[model samples]
Target: MTETARTRYFLLAILLIALAAAWPELSQPGLLNTRGGGDSPFLLQRLQQLETAVLDGHFPVRWMPDANYGYGYPFYNFYAPLSIYITFLFRLIGFSFVRSIHLSHLLGYFVAGWGMFLLARRWFAHGGAGNGWAGLLAAAAYTVAPFHLVNVYVRGDSLAEFWAMAFYPLVILAADGLFGGGRRGVALFGLAYAGLILSHNISALIFSPFLLLYLLLRMRFLTKKQENYPQACTEQSRSISQITQIGFFKSYKNLRNLCNLRIANPIFGFLLALALAAWFFVPALAEQSLAQLDAVTSGYFYYSNHFLGTADQPLIQSTFFVDYGVVDREAFRMGLVQTAVSAAGL
Candidate 1:
């Protein structure tokens, strides 16, 4: 509402517009060609399979072997269905299936800008000590983060990663509210968890443990406070403390309390994300592919073998050629350098 605040938002708006304009080029059928790089073809194949399913009204599982993908390939059993369902909805709007898939990704990245704004506002609320400047700082920092540039330049990986990262802090906040005993807030917590899980399973997995750790610490604090209450009103407190302390005698006691507390909702959220592919949890759970894991691990080894082993190697050796086009290896190099400089600034 002040002049400085207006200036900050204005700059953010301009940066967002620039990001939006860059999307089409990054994902254009031919230009900036990273789509043919390792694991990329598999992602595109999965999307193409979804497009086919949307057209045929049938789900197909074996478009390609999972061994060609990254760490989260087993989760494709989950991702495929979600993508098909969404593509179908877009088709209903008269868009071609291929266009729909591309548009979905483009729009997903575009909306991420708004998510960045929300994150910044939330950070400002806490870190700014209620000052507007803090929020603006967060927004600008997020907008210019090297990761955002990578997400924008690389098309397929952008949507899910951006969505997951953008919504990650909100998931923490919602879970925080739920653990605080506001039942209605728990539903929002559930919604945020569900959304992120659906967007990207691996990203969700990486985030889930952190979410659980935070919740456990917060809940323990609450329990401690309750224990300090009058004895007549602390029946639950006594019972919970006894259960947690029971582990002093038996390791299983801790497991029993964990089951009772259902402290694993974060894990459940991780598993539930598999619903993007199947109706019941079991079917998706079963289809997770170990081959995908192998492929991902190999890719990492490939990258490390080339880069870390020899510093004087061609800077471009670490880069993969995706199809007929070339990635700007220098852009990546500069991006990392800039990122380090930016973090130091922070």
Candidate 2:
């Protein structure tokens, strides 16, 4: 197939996976059951609060009017703003808040699939995975990932996290492309990393170390010397010893080029990314003491009590934590299909 045709095919397949993953939201005809369950209700309320605050000329929206039973709180000061802002854009264009939420979910899934496809294809090209089908499989695996679906349909639909996940591959791809030689590479990496931070601060924090490790490995790949030694010296006029010495001399001379890893790419990219995301995180960290971190971390929501895979319970049953609350509990499993795929991989 032509290059354009191949691109189209990849995109079409990705689009189908995105649509399939978001089918539940697309199929519901009536208004969203905001009260159905999970954190969706809280997120919807936050969306409306954001709209109100924005309309009131609150650019950063630190204080929310209706938080804590009508006494306002600095909701936007700490919360990541990208997802709600995106859904609010649809609201500005005349879509209802409910409809906007649905649309955002669709858009999030599609973006996730697209990002994964691009990253997977690049990885395949670099000989990390098989080409063509590998990209599609990666995208599909991520889009319909078990915990992701459970988060969307069960855990109050953490739209921020969904959007954050969508941007992960894009950030990695941009960082990887930094070594491929282009003036725009660092700028693009900066933007992608900024998007990740703005989408979900926690996700950005969790993924940062992994990103740094990957970049270090990539730099190593660039600096590692090639090992194509002369098997049979053909030119007898130039003795084998002479040929070997010449080859060694040339390799030694070009050592600088081989080790030409742009160590500044990540530093510059990270500085730019920090500058871009400063609008949110600056006030977030600075003014965090005003907010009661104890309230957020204490009680049933204690950070230590809810770590995944940390519990000794069986994976299937351990999915359900905090069984004491009156709220309906949903146990999320990482699907049998994914397990089978993992087994096949092993």
Candidate 3:
């Protein structure tokens, strides 16, 4: 067999191994239900409040304290109602809130995986490295990522992260289109971005800066292309020269080109997005924006830990890059490196 076949088979083997490792976690009921009964119960309680308010025609803007929790609502300043609306829809259809949330995660995972595959395909095509294998690798890598696995385990605010991860590929497509890649990519991008914003406000906030930076990079690439136009012009260079000779006018034209991306290819897809978004956006926004808000004392927990001498407790922090466990330093170090290497597909 050829080297490519060998590599493909190897990747397939690795994928199967990973999936096998994940089976125990996935097979168990509520495997993603990390909040367990305590947090899950609280989450359901919030959804119940949201359901009542929506049915009553006034979903509160800020969250109200759950009678059971007694403490004020912890999620005041940060609020996004996509998950709540999803739960409410299920409740309307006779499903329990917990079941509805679980179903949403299960379904959302499919969308995320498919979207990632398509996005990776498009990206590889654009990069002149058209490999379906690469796309598959990326899609699988993202879907079974540690962050995603952890989210499944915790199964609370992490739902937002899952939604964000799922839509990320589309965002890249849209940004690419905005820079003159293609109308379809741009349109898919806009619809994806809007859906992401509506699903998780915090994720949108975090993603916006990266989107803007990509635009900036594309603009720079255009400038470099113009500068490389030859002194003795070919047809392409003549066009470039004519355009670049206009100086500020050329700059303005480039900016306008980047900004005015009217996507026509994905009209149907975007329309579906619009329909889904309409179901929840306004009500969710109203509830989130108007809810009684509070400012948590940032770092208070950290400071309080110091005061109690528990600050010295070993930390187990896991996210994109940082993974540390204080319980066993040697094990932690070995695990971190191994996990990082595996994640990088080494």
lDDT against the true structure, per candidate, is: 0.50, 0.73, 0.54
In candidate 3, what are the lDDT values of residues 149-243, reduced to their tens digit? 55554444456666677677767766665433343443566577777876676677677788767766765775667533222112222334454
Task: For candidate 3, give the lDDT.
Answer: 0.54
Error of 1 at 154 (Å): 4.0
lDDT of 1 by residue, 1-346 (tens): 7756765665567456545545565455542445455333434555555555435654444332334453223334544234334544666788754565555544554445445555456545664535345544455555545555555455444445655655675676566545423234435666777777666656776787887788778668767666322321233233345544656325545444543454433333333344432352355556555334455447643434434224543432233322213353333333334545556877
Worst 10 residues of 3 by lDDT: 228-237
Strongest candidate by TM-score: 2
Residue range with the least summed lDDT across 10 consecutive positions in model 1: 228-237
Could you tell me the lDDT of residue 245 within candidate 3?
68
- Per-residue lDDT for 1-346 in model 2, tens only? 6767877888998888888888887797533443254456677787899999989998867778888889887877887889889889889999888788888888898898889888888878865434767888889988987666665776655888889988999999999866643436668999999999999888898899999999998777766853221211111112223533667436433433322434545665787899999999998889877778777758865644555554442333332332212233324444345556667966
Question: What CA root-mean-square deviation does each model show from the true structure?
Answer: 8.3, 9.9, 9.5
For lDDT, the strongest prediction is 2
Could you tell me the lDDT of residue 17 within candidate 3?
A: 44
lDDT of 1: 0.50
Cα TM-score of candidate 1: 0.58
